[model samples]
Target: MGRKRRLITDSFPKVKRRKGGPGPGKEDGAPEPGLRGEEPCEEILAAHLDETHLEILRQFDLNRHFGPCTGITRLQRWERAEQLGLEPPQEVLKVLWAHPEDPQYQCSLWHLYPI
Candidate 1:
């Protein structure tokens, strides 16, 4: 007769390790890197804006949208403009949104409107 085989069914507990830097409880109390404790500047650049342009900017701020026009894709920019009731020229809007870091988009703006 063949010998009977023994079955193993025991499981080991999992061990958890710390991830990344440190947890909240382990904080050293120094202000985290790149963080400042002062309020940001609130200066408005409305000196050159007419009532209509100012209203548009106010709507943009009321919607909590900031940053370059090109923060979103071209399609998204148009959709957002429509949603916000803004009708600025498409070329002007494109120039405003083009990423400053991208030389190609920046140069394209000059081509669109000669100085």
Candidate 2:
């Protein structure tokens, strides 16, 4: 028990803190990945979705089966909910289909569902 101790600061590498912000990644405005789903585009959803439909999606987002609604498309979430006997609004599926392949609506919840 007579060994010299190494200072905590000397034991770790030093990182210069950026004055503006942490990084260009999250500072630009995006939710912490895996913490929650990317919020659905309300502007787009508003055009097709009513209050009822919006609420349905919100509830599903808060209460999901596999993971945060982040990596999966809204359509996929609706299907999973149906499988679990949770009747999410059908408009979600319809809106997803009607829209022309938005980058937002295309994703995977860490898995390419097997066919």
Candidate 3:
């Protein structure tokens, strides 16, 4: 009987790419509130926020004892959303910019803080 021969190959497993960075699905494109060239209304914005901001709100919504107050400011929220690859509604941004200190219901400010 002949001795068994071993095969040596240099092929190694490919390194899997980690899912990171802002992708298309979440990139901040134009705020599309399910319509064309139309501004997203409060309702649509709320829906979008609920889908995205739920988790973030939990972290930033401080003053828990005082009841669900947004820990961070409106500007922080907008920046976070943008960082997360989400396009904040133009109207929402406008509303926040108009009243940086005061919160607005249209931007879901009521949800995080008492407005």
User: lDDT winner among the candidates?
Assistant: 2
Q: Report the CA-based lDDT of candidate 1 relative to the real structure.
A: 0.45
lDDT score for residue 53 of model 3:
48
Q: State how far residue 82 of model 1 sits from its true place (Å).
A: 1.3
After the best TM-score superposition of candidate 1, give how far the Cα of residue 79 lies from its true spot, in angstroms.
Answer: 1.4
Assess candidate 3 and give its TM-score to the true structure.
0.30
Give the per-residue lDDT digits (tens) of candidate 1, residues 1-115. 5987655633555556577756655675656543554333332333333334434433443343433343343334545666777663454354435444544433322234434
TM-score of each: 0.20, 0.35, 0.30
lDDT of each residue in 2-112, candidate 3, tens digit only: 987655643565555448654556655655456755754787787786555443433333423323334555566666766766665555455455445544432344554
Please estimate how well model 3 matches the true structure, expressed as its whole-model Cα lDDT. Answer: 0.51
Each candidate: RMSD: 13.6, 12.0, 15.4
What are the Cα lDDT values of the candidates?
0.45, 0.60, 0.51
Angstrom error at residue 78, model 2? 1.2
Q: Note the clash tally of each candidate.
A: 2, 0, 3
Ranking of models by lDDT: 2, 3, 1
Tens-digit lDDT track of model 2 for 1-115: 9998889899799878779675744665566753446555665467465555445545555665534566567677777777888777666676567554754333433335553
Q: Quick one: RMSD of model 1?
A: 13.6
Candidate 2 wrong stretches, greater than 4 Å: 1-67, 106-115
